[model samples]
Target: MTPGLLVQSQGRVLPVGLSVLSTRGKRELELPDRGLVVGAVRPGSPAARAALRPGTREEAFRGGVIVLGGDVITAADRQLVDAFEDLQSVLIDRKEGDPVTLTVVRGGQTRTVQLTLDASAFRVQGR
Candidate 1:
């Protein structure tokens, strides 16, 4: 089925449900900013449904944390992430149907979004 169709049948998915590259990879590729770069988004995935675009920098932001050249990801739920791995580790521990709150900086503006984890047909590799 098409990704969109799958999402319609399901609901908001989590872990942002997108294929991402590390910020270091982004820099090596000479891409824009040094942040997690969204590479591909699964069809019917929450990331796809949420309109997270490929090539966008993933950043976590808050008052005391400084992200040099990328967007800031402030928090996930009530937990603050010191690094990308911190966020990934937390998501890894969560199960489908769990809820997550994400604070992100996009276009120099901050937005808080809520998402629900969904079961994917394929498991995330190398988790």
Candidate 2:
């Protein structure tokens, strides 16, 4: 299947409503690539409803060192996520309001969060 930013839900292609920046882009923003920094989150979107903030960084740390980013997405309804594309791929097939579990690193601590998907028009940029 082709990888893209849009997902099919309820017979319509919709945006997942998350603004994710790559780890490399994070470096340019002066934020350590602790994880993929959520550059911007659509207001009232699934991610926003899930309490995911724009500056939130999703990563895993051990012994005070970053081990990985964009590689730890695990939804309750899906398998392990190896990349951002994998995560998006899963989202595409799921309906809005589907529940997902995310393991993220924030404030030097690892936390598990639950999220629901939201549908929106297409957006090309994270910010």
- Evaluate all candidate structures by whole-model CA lDDT and list the values in order: 0.45, 0.45
| Lowest-sum lDDT 10-residue window in model 1 | 1-10
Candidate 2: where is the Cα deviation over 4 Å?
1-35, 56-82, 121-127
Q: Tally clashing residue pairs in candidate 1.
A: 11
TM-score versus the correct structure, for each prediction? 0.48, 0.48
> What is candidate 1's TM-score against the reference?
0.48
Clashing pairs in 2: none
Q: Report the Cα lDDT for candidate 2.
A: 0.45
Task: List, residue by residue over 10-37, the lDDT tens digit for candidate 1.
Answer: 4432232112434674355343332233
lDDT per residue for candidate 2 within 10-80, as digits (tens), equals 66643322234356644553333333334345676666677764543424222111222222222334444
* Highest-lDDT candidate: 1
10 residues in a row with least lDDT, candidate 2: 61-70
